[model samples]
Target: MIKSVLFDLDGTLLPLNQDDFAREYLTHIGAKVAQVIDPKKFVSQLLASTDVMVRNKDKTKTNQQVFLEDFLHKIGVAREILLPVIDEFYETDFVLVKSITRRAAAARQAIMAVIECGLDVVVATNPIFPASAVRQRLAWAGVDDINFKLITSYEQSHFCKPHVEYYLEIAAHLGRLPAECLMVGNDVKEDLAAARIGMTTYLVTDCLLNVKNAVINTDYQGTLQELAQTIAQIIKER
Candidate 1:
């Protein structure tokens, strides 16, 4: 009885190499902020700070807080100085990164199929970026802001994926049990983790990442075209 479907953005929907996307994202932000600060020193420090934050063990702090605290510590400048610059990056530079991503028609078709089936659709992209940045990425995926019932961004999310709590939080927000939700994603760890709490899982293999060597034992695994058919089958079975 899956009542909702959650989709990951970067690889699952937007079809891209995660490393290439990250490099482009960092380069764009770094270049834009160079006018305000020393480019070499700022990017180097920012990358170092990001590494530290990624390894942070605190569950209480949002990813944004962790990253910003680390960033401010390295820059030693008023946070206000960087706020507008970051905002500008999201508004302008972030959109330019779309050039690196190829639109997946099957992804869009799958999303529409889920919506047509009366299932809620959630953009469950990792909550590492702000809402504006997430929105920009969604646009790259051909998903309008109105497509998803909920879009997970750092501001609204308290936990990152691979943590069952993050999935639980989304279930709570949607007022649905995990058992009634299906998480469709490319990452074995981050997306499939929702299954721990009872959500049905679908691994979109087109952009799959199996870094942890986790054995993918899920029953549902396929390409975007297969997913569209799977959803149709589910509807027919109902």
Candidate 2:
């Protein structure tokens, strides 16, 4: 009864080394904003803001607001000053980092298969970055500008990955039960957390991350094409 398919962006839908991706992202953005503030300081402050967003428990404030408040405070600037820089950086500079990332055709095929089955598709990437940044990354994946049912950016999300509450929130937002959703991701801890709350899970192993060395117990696991086949099989059975 999987009515929705949630996909992770970084290593799942887009092939990339997470560490390398982060470094490239920061370097490009820092270089772009260096004229206004110290590049090193800007990077540090942005990271601190991400940490604050991760630890955020307040449901009232979106992760975006929490990040902005902390980021703007640490950098000693108004949102008016910092916001434009970030927006422009994502628009112009973020594209340069795509050189380190490669296309994931399996992911594109899988997404198309899911949509063809008449199931909802959601981009459940970790909400550490803003919508503009997320959109740009999706563009790099070759599926940019396609309308997904939802895209979890820091501006709209309240919780980060590895938290069951985040999955629950997505389920709620989609008006579906966890049992009716399938969570697809490359991270064992973060993506598989959906299973804890009753959703089915798929682990995409092409660029998998298992930092905790935790045992994986998802319903299915494999490359993105295999994942698509699994979903198709499930839908065919239904």
Q: Which candidate tops TM-score? A: 2
User: How displaced is residue 229 in candidate 2, in Å?
Assistant: 2.7
For 4-57, candidate 1 gives per-residue lDDT tens digits of: 888889899889988888788888888998878877787887778766655555
**Please, what are the lDDT tens digits per residue for candidate 2 over residues 1-238?**
8899899999998889989998998889988887788899988988888888888888898888888888887897667877788789877788899999998777788889999988999999999887888888898888886679999998889999888888989999999999999899999988998999999888999899999899989888998878766778865653
RMSD of each: 2.2, 1.5
Any residue pairs clashing in model 1, and if so which? Answer: none
Each prediction's whole-model lDDT (CA): 0.82, 0.87
TM-score quality measure for candidate 2: 0.94
Stretches of candidate 1 off by over 4 Å are: 48-61, 235-238
Q: How close to the true structure is residue 112 of candidate 2, measured as C-alpha lDDT?
A: 90
